[model samples]
Target: MSLAAQDAAKIPEEIEWTWEVRPAHADAKLPNVLLLGDSITRNYFPEVTQDLTGVANVYLMASSTCVGDPRIEHQIAEFATMEGVRFQVVHFNNGMHGWGYSEAQYKAAFPAFMRTVRALTLESSTLIWASTTPVRIDKEVGPTNARVDERNKIALALITSAKISLDDQHALMMEHRDLYKDDIHFNDAGSKIQGDQAAAQIRAALSMNRLPKAQAR
Candidate 1:
């Protein structure tokens, strides 16, 4: 078995799924932007794409794999290899799923996530870390804001140290508790808010080191 398969056998989950979207850009002229995250990222991807429009060609790689899972890096690597496109900006998040893993496990495995993400920094890719959103639902068995806070804190230290831009979705959603579609996911409005903010951040990063239009692929 492969390393990812071996990792999979170590800790099985209730379910596992991955979703990726790479819109065709025949003779594409716009720079590419990649959004990497879970369902929440998937929710906001459309809005980001719409917001970016002619500015950039947006790509999405959202999965249920959490930071603690060894397979997550493999998933990211495989997705990156499959696309074979230079990402001008990569906005990413995790920490919503993989409830089976302990917070300690999450932190322990987070460095590997950073390593995988940093590999995409080729060609001056601007990296932005989207803080995982809050959990509004009070459930007998589900995510909690306390755990979310801990994970964000752990991630923030690394991101800040690395100088990656931050899109604080958790802090944003904290102000709009009513916008949740469910315990974890957001409503259309919340998603729009997140997407618009994400797009604004991406734009700032892109403008910081504006590649000549001639460099677009």
Candidate 2:
């Protein structure tokens, strides 16, 4: 098996949990965020939450499933049922799921994915769509990083016309190529960098600047 597949199989089937920055935080009401993405975002959530302290209430869920699966819909539905968790930012990534799908499949499901996202929250919640990060195709990663790039463009187009803000994670990954441990995944340091970038994007979209040190927890 490829390294990606091997690594994926080792991940527990149940939702892998992480240390959440508690809601008792001083800035708890700033905004609530839900991170939805594949392994890359999954691996990077800790770093994301760290930089986001005092800026938002962040919850993360990682799935290795592709964008075409029914599980994507199911996952969103489960999150929607979280009582009293008011989400102000729903940051998500999914082109990795679209990577190997046929052209027809991607075209059909892309809109459905957006609809699902829109249906998940209040009409005013800011939606940030991350472009698929670059991969080194020559390595044992997935098929082609180029495919990821293509799908990112599709995602950008969809979000732009829909008027949702887009976080260019592809650009972030390229800016720090050394962060990646392999073609498609980041080591801990890289993951932290990615998380920091994501925090910045969400901050910008919501106009929530980083708070003073004395005020942050």
Candidate 3:
């Protein structure tokens, strides 16, 4: 089985090896886009890929690896070597993995993460930074509400100066709390909405001017 397929088969245990295949530029007929995040991106796979159909070629790869995992550094290294390719977009989030981290740790790691992302893609490509989605915190999987909020704050501050655009995922989830299945993840519908929202943010930032239809009332 393909490495991505193997990763898809089991629940993510460690973030150590998310991508075993090195995606080549020739593999993409459209502009290459990568989705880097936790389970939300995993669950929202279809929607995120579907939404970007004509705009770009979207690649989804995420591990449940939280903010502090040494795995992120590896992922960044994999990304850096792909430079000069036709990559045009990258939508990523790390807060769900970050729930366990202290506020100070998250703050310190935020800029380094952004720098890694910046180094990988050219300035011409747009990087979409999705804020950590709101965690219920009332439940048990991980990450208290306080920590989630603090991480989001740190994420906002770090990306602001780095030319990265924010998705405000935290606000979107809070505005629609019914979407989550637990403290740190969302249901299928929630994932789809999240994907659409991220796509919208990208469109807006790039002046792509192509917004998908609004959710039904």
Candidate 4:
């Protein structure tokens, strides 16, 4: 093979992306909430932080990789081990970026992913599972609605079986489809709506966390 061809072949087929946002002064007195997901979460993160300003200290652990990806475990572990931090609620979603994998593969990996996440958190922490947002039909950058629907069904099943709280971001986006800026992402208005919903869920989870064991029971 030619040198250029060999060099091209050396390139990896998969690339892993990760990022985090830790507040400089995360109030120890208030509840800590972790938001985990992909670009959609990144886009709306500011609004979520703002909306939850005094209510809770929100941290973001997001990446372009899917929950099924091994790297995600590392990311979760890193966040879980943050010094003197205990999350009161964790809101997580993953489905948009694993387009290369079939629905079955996605389904098969979900339980393990949830297990890893659960193992890393405090037992008392509320685990809220956010459904993947809607995808518009696009031949390029494709994640057709059909594919998203399939993955969401699998996620719903896993979440239901585990008895986690559902944030239902999918239904919210579907109701405001016109606010989408493209096939995958939302515009400013749409992001605020998503942020509001996320903040609301986080607040509810934190409030529940404060209840007496008997009342919560």
Which candidate tops lDDT?
1
Residue-level lDDT of model 4, residues 1-217, one tens digit each, is 5433332222212666777898889887888888889889988889999999998888898887675455567667776776447678888889888666567667767888898778756778999998999876644545878888899899999899999999999999999989989878999999999999998988988888899988887
**Per-residue lDDT for 169 in model 3?**
80
What are the TM-scores, per candidate, against the unseen true structure?
Answer: 0.90, 0.77, 0.76, 0.89
- Location of the lowest summed lDDT over 10 successive residues in candidate 1: 1-10
Give the winner by TM-score: 2 or 4. Answer: 4
Alpha-carbon runs more than 4 Å astray in model 2: 1-28, 82-84, 98-100, 139-141, 208-217
In the range 72-93, model 2's lDDT, one tens digit per residue, is 6766666667534656788888
Task: Please provide, for model 1 over 57-174, each residue's C-alpha lDDT reduced to its tens digit, 9 standing for 90 to 100.
Answer: 8999999988877789889999989988878899999988887777777877787898898886565678999999998765566688888889899999988988888999898999
TM-score of 2: 0.77
Pairs that collide in candidate 3 are: 66-97, 67-97
Runs of candidate 4 exceeding 4 Å displacement: 1-15, 82-84
> Candidate 3, 83: how far from true, in Å?
9.8
How much is the lDDT of residue 185 in candidate 2?
88
- Residue 128's lDDT within candidate 2 is 86
User: If ranked by lDDT, best first, what sequence of candidates would result?
Assistant: 1, 4, 2, 3
Model 3 TM:
0.76
